[model samples]
Target: MHYESPVREPLVIGDKTYHDITRDVARPIETTAPKMWWIAFSIAMAMFLWGVGGILWTIANGIGSWGLNKTVGWAWDITNFVWWVGIGHAGTLISAVLLLFRQKWRMSINRSAEAMTIFSVIQAALFPVIHMGRVWLAYFVLPIPNQFGSLWVNFNSPLLWDVFALSTYLSVSTVFWYVGLIPDFAMIRDRAVNPIQKHIYKILSFGWGGKVKHWQRFEEVSLVLAGLATPLVLSVHTIVSMDFATSVIPGWHTTIFPPYFVAGAIFSGFAMVQTLLIITRKLFNLEDYITIQHIEMMNIIIMLTGSIVGVAYITELFIAWYSGVEYEQYAFLNRATGPYWWAYWSMMTCNVFSPQFMWSKKLRTNLIFTFIISIVVNIGMWFERFVIIVTSLHRDYLPSSWSMFSPTAVDIAFFLGSIGFFFVLFLLYARTFPVIAQAELKTILKSSGEKHKKHHSDDNHGHH
Candidate 1:
């Protein structure tokens, strides 16, 4: 029943077999850590420790440790939150949305993308919690009963909706991720020579024996979850957009925010995925499994989303000018020409202009160019959030309140620390977990694997 068009390139290159797939995937976990892994881990660990120090400093010193001023109340914290959250969007899109569409290419990269989603969402969640200053009072954001005179969370607040949206997204994504891991865990369990390893994977695998019923249920649950998660990929970021759109602030208030934010999220999320997958393929020597076809496929998505983001940018400017509201127009103008103009232009160059290069088939398919563009797109995304959040708030209605914002060392540390922490989690996951879904990849081996394609071609040549 498995069929792939002959014109389509093979997904799994280099004549890989099922056994080879399992061995290559399990190698990192079974073998001793390579020196490069150790070196990378040490660097990431150092960065994470430095970030931890910054978090501790903030906790000890309060919000005063940041560079937030009266005019710019929300700065790096919100920017980073949105950026991380945006990055988190790609995982579910890759896993859930693509699954619903029955895209087989997802099988290779979906595992790591899901991990990235969970880890990045964790990083995004940290900012709002830390921004609370009184971290103990963070529980108040939740609706649980407290001793504070029966006070409840405000239902109207978009922030509360974020709590619901982000938590739901995380829960579903985690379940979806773990469910996919079960069969792979069982693979490792069966392969384990060490009793302790076997015992651990046994529990992790949940007694999966590759029964027909097991697969049937797995497919059912995955379809159900994908259906559930598909809406989330859109809803979560839409609610996030409401955080800005609901506000009455000039640049902040707009109907375009929801779609704009969602597109930007996908744009940046794919870029991060590209960054992670490229590095992963290099480090793990998974070039055959994670092929150029996969890279080109991802690049196509990046290009599409990046174009959508660019259009959103222009739409925002048009709306600002067309709205006839002086403040709104001024906000957009200031973004490009004000003190923060550099950030705005950086966003433009990175986000708006860079992805245009993907139009070239040669460039999008080229590994090195793709990697560079991926980093560029992420940088642009960060700047985009900064421009949107800061530029809007820095200038108020009254001239007296207008002031520029700057980040203190603590602010920089927290941002760098989050990056460190993200990589720390990803590195550990890459080493321990099956970074690629071997079970799923096996299903498509006959249809899209290189060996099968070679055979098909040879048969056609013989008939000719």
Candidate 2:
């Protein structure tokens, strides 16, 4: 077993040097794609449209058009909401968490992960809005000093807290992402020959030259943002858990939910990143920059978090049984032996059992298997949330009040449509952005901090 060191050393380049990203590694970044990618992109686009049509259908008809019944009022919408939100976690972790740790490899993939955060957040924000059913009056969730009265927003409600927390988290993440893009924008801006492209990038670069002092301060601000975002990532997911844990429901009342949810978020988020990266590294011809080493490192994380998530599941069941709380025990048992057995077992197989394969390097390192496992992990995660939200609520207390709810056609379409929505945006992003962050890539190329390498930035960079 190799103990991979985490230290990074800076690399210095003379002011006159020109970077040749194409020749930086064994493989060129411009990949020759098979026709299938176009087909896939098209299909994803169609899915996004169909998903939108479903949303529109719900809007026209009503929120009651879907399968959410009295008992399971928060079925698919909340499930999808948490799932997408969880998926957003890994991006912040990759960009913010690793940056604080000074993990240089993060540079090569951080931009894509940041884009994932932005896109996933977009996908996530849709659920709360659409789940409101009236869609148009969904603004009711927003707090405005109303003509009805001076009654303020509910400071007491977690859902209201969600309104505040999610918006703040999303806004901060977006700004941090855009700020990081400035230097990279300058690179592309300087390289662009097309008049229109040059104009767009010129405004974006904000007259950033490669000035040494500017680079120094840029580094400082980037680090500061990284520090802020790291905690925000944890806090955001923890708040999402509060939406559940703060409740009185048997399974929902556990103290474990926050960390468990956070771990699950990172677990699923990384799996999503892996899914995109596997295709991205190949499609963008970024194998050299992304490297097998990069994949292996991520696999290690997937394994660790996948295992952590598995433990959370088991721990939940165990605590329920151990606490001697009839309600809690029954909540879990109902999940396994009750009507939702299929969903429960599916979650276990996808999240718990599949990741066990990664314990073996041969399995984790296999490109196809890794990708398939990543997909399975995501599926398991979605089901885990579904089982948690729906199963627990579907038959809460009092058997007389117990009921079942299956999603309507609208629910199915909207759910699948969001998948399309996420991918469609992602595909377009890949085509337009560097996909691999050039500036961050330079940071990675710097020496191992263990080796204590000297560093330098170009004089042609940001303004003095």
Candidate 3:
């Protein structure tokens, strides 16, 4: 029953045994820090500290330190917020949705993808909190008792919905990720040589006994969580799109936003996964586990989502023109031809045209080409958010209310600092956690492993 087609490339190459997997995954954690890890860690730490300094500067100086005028109030912070949230979408999709559909390919990459989701969502959560001029008053966004004077939260607002949606997402994703890590934690617990290490992992593993009933319950719980999480994969991004779709802004007011945002989120999310996994496999020497097949599978997703995003872009333009609404048409036109036209074209070229390169089988499988394209796609996705937020607001119906927007040094700092912060978390996770879900990977070895497949073929030949 466990037979993979001959045409299907092996998921795990190098004829790896189960022991080899445990050894490879544990090596980075058990061994002393490698030179490259230190180099990468030092650079990431510097970036994180710089960003922390920027965050402190903003807190001290107030929102005035940021580049916000009356007309273009929501700029870089909101843009980055949406961008980070979009990046988190791929993790849930890979873990929850793929799990529901019974995709075995997810086994190798889900751990890192889920970690990326949790970290990126952390970054996303920070923006809205900081965007509030008084971070102390952030509790006002939540619905609390009337004892606190009259700071009632508006139930109708998408902003309020964002608070609810994002929190739920972060909570569910964290739980899902941790639940899946239990068995892996137990594996490390058993392997730990040091008493302290053993005690730490033993507690983390929750005294998992690997009993028949324990595994039975584990499988049921994973399925239940996956089922619960599957809808969130769609709902989270749909709600995120509502932040714009529910708006009256010309470019922002569109029915297509929910699906459009969802697709764009997956598009950018997959690209980020590619970016991280490429570096991870190389750094950890996990080529046998995270293979070209994995890379190609991810690329194929990036292409599909990228193409959907391209169509959405075209649909937006056509809708703007066809709606006979001058304001809508002007919004799209200004994006392509106004002061921030560079941003618009960058989005187009990077999000739309760059992914088209993946149409070639040779290119999608090419690691260097995939890495470069991955970066390009993320850059394009960032520009896409910028153009949408900045362009739509810069020129409104009333000429007197119209004004341009630019970022202060603080704006740049917060953005770059977030990147550093994200990597700092991921690098730590890479070192400490099993980057690949080794337990789940073992399930696929008999069917999709190169050596196992050859053995099965020989047995068939002998029988015949």
TM-score, prediction 2: 0.90
Off by over 4 Å in 1: 457-464
Off by over 4 Å in 2: 1-18, 22-34, 446-464
Ten-residue stretch with the least lDDT total in model 3: 1-10
RMSD of each: 1.2, 6.1, 1.3
The estimated TM-scores of all candidates read 0.98, 0.90, 0.98
Q: Write the per-residue lDDT of candidate 3 for residues 137-158, one digit (tens) a residue.
A: 7888889976668768998998
Each model's total of backbone clashes: 0, 13, 0
Q: Write the per-residue lDDT of candidate 1 for residues 251-341, one digit (tens) a residue.
A: 9999988999999999999999999999999988889888898899889899899899899999989999999999999999999999999
Cα TM-score of candidate 1: 0.98
> Which candidate's lDDT is highest?
1
- In candidate 3, stretches whose alpha carbon ends up further than 4 angstroms from where it belongs are 149-151
Q: Is candidate 1 or candidate 2 better by lDDT?
A: 1
